[model samples]
Target: MALAAAAFTAGCGGGAPRLASYVSPQFGYTIPHPAAWHRVETDGGRRVWFLPQAPPAAQPPEQTAVDFLVVMTRDDPGPLPEIDVRRLAMSLLPMHGVSGFQRAPRGNEEIAWYRFELTGATGGREWASVGLLVTGPKRLHYVVCAGALERWRTAQKVCDEVLRGFVPGDLSR
Candidate 1:
């Protein structure tokens, strides 16, 4: 988590770039991502997917250095649970094979949003990542933004933009 935060801040001193909207008709949600990123549908369009544009001259152009996903969850009764970002971040360590896991210091405190950071092996390589968990009135939303540790610095701004711009839909409709 420390590594991911450092990478996020290192190259993200300037303001975030423009974003493009991604809306889901079934779920009625809308989120923004970097305009340069490409969208690819999967799971028969049940899920939303976006991949960051690799920097010029990157060794493997096809390598998904950074990616984002918006996932919808089942409806539940009662009030939403207060998500402990620190505990939540630590909980992912075992599942992601993360050796060092920590939650970044909180920067924003939205009523429905929680953020986390982690490092783990993916595709035989180490990745530094961040994720946002959001709760809507009728359902839960999860957004994961991750990139290779080496290139995460360059990808952080886009990740932040996407997470911050997320707007969940009106599930009651």
Candidate 2:
């Protein structure tokens, strides 16, 4: 409900980004993302969009895509239930390596995180995850992350813009 933007090292350059407004009423939120980027829906029917991870290549469909999590549940009020969102994420990745993520820093409204690459074929994959963790009513914590190599340096601006654009709606009311 406030203007607390997420911070991370996902790279993209241009003027202030205006993300497209989310249409589905399921998410109950919307924000401005950069124009031109395409929103690719996943097979399971979860709303997904491109985060501009890599330059367009002639083949291989762009090794990866920086995507956002559930759209409707953007403002999850939790004492965080026994939800296995992490396990669900792991099942999506190629059946090769595992990721060991850890808490790196904590701020008043923002908690920065880091991911340790445990076993993977891709080189330099550790990421710092910056997201909003809603503790309860009016208590939302923003977080940011990136590859351990250049965590803060690379994600400074993009993290700010994305997190600031976060919006949530009241479902129970």
Candidate 3:
């Protein structure tokens, strides 16, 4: 894949970040992510990592993660003979409370992916998100990477890199 590395200017005035690869044997997938983001554990065996737009204050709050990437796996219900890209997009629309929902193209042949944008209802926040749906040998995989829409112009490159570098592993093991 032609995943060009475009220069990214941090919205928080931080320097350009170095990327690192995260490999999960259990989930059977590999993805490159920003080295600065902290990996946090969420429910349902899901892996979530996030980085705040700005540096933390002297006294950080309960949580600081803002922009994030999430990867999870589920059992594949076989091929989708009834679903096309548009129909799949419609079925996976962002949940309520996220307005201005729209889908774009994302991912590769092994992985059916889609891009979406939305405005948060509370603060009118803008977000850019990408979803990757992988039909693994024994299971299905989904990955999402999202960031502030204001930073998307520069962040899109990194997001693309993550998707392109993502390698699907054997979940049936």
Q: Quick one: best lDDT, which candidate?
A: 1
Which is the leading candidate under TM-score? 3
lDDT (Cα, tens digit) per residue for candidate 2, span 1-173: 01112212112443334445554454344544444445544433334444433324542211342222222132434323313334432443332443454433432222222222322222334333344433333222222212222333344344446546655443232
lDDT of 3 by residue, 39-102 (tens): 5544445544444333255522113322556666666653222244335433432423333323
What's the lDDT for residue 1 in model 1?
Answer: 37
Model 2 stretches astray by more than 4 angstroms? 1-18, 53-63, 66-124, 135-154
Give per-model CA RMSD. 7.6, 9.5, 7.6
TM-score, one value per model: 0.60, 0.44, 0.62
lDDT of each: 0.53, 0.35, 0.51
> Candidate 1 residues 45-115, lDDT tens each?
65466654332353322233333343433353212455443444445332253333332243223225566
Candidate 1 matches the true fold with a TM-score of: 0.60
**Which wins on lDDT, candidate 1 or candidate 2?**
1
Query: Candidate 1: misplaced stretches above 4 Å?
Result: 1-18, 53-66, 69-79, 83-111, 171-173
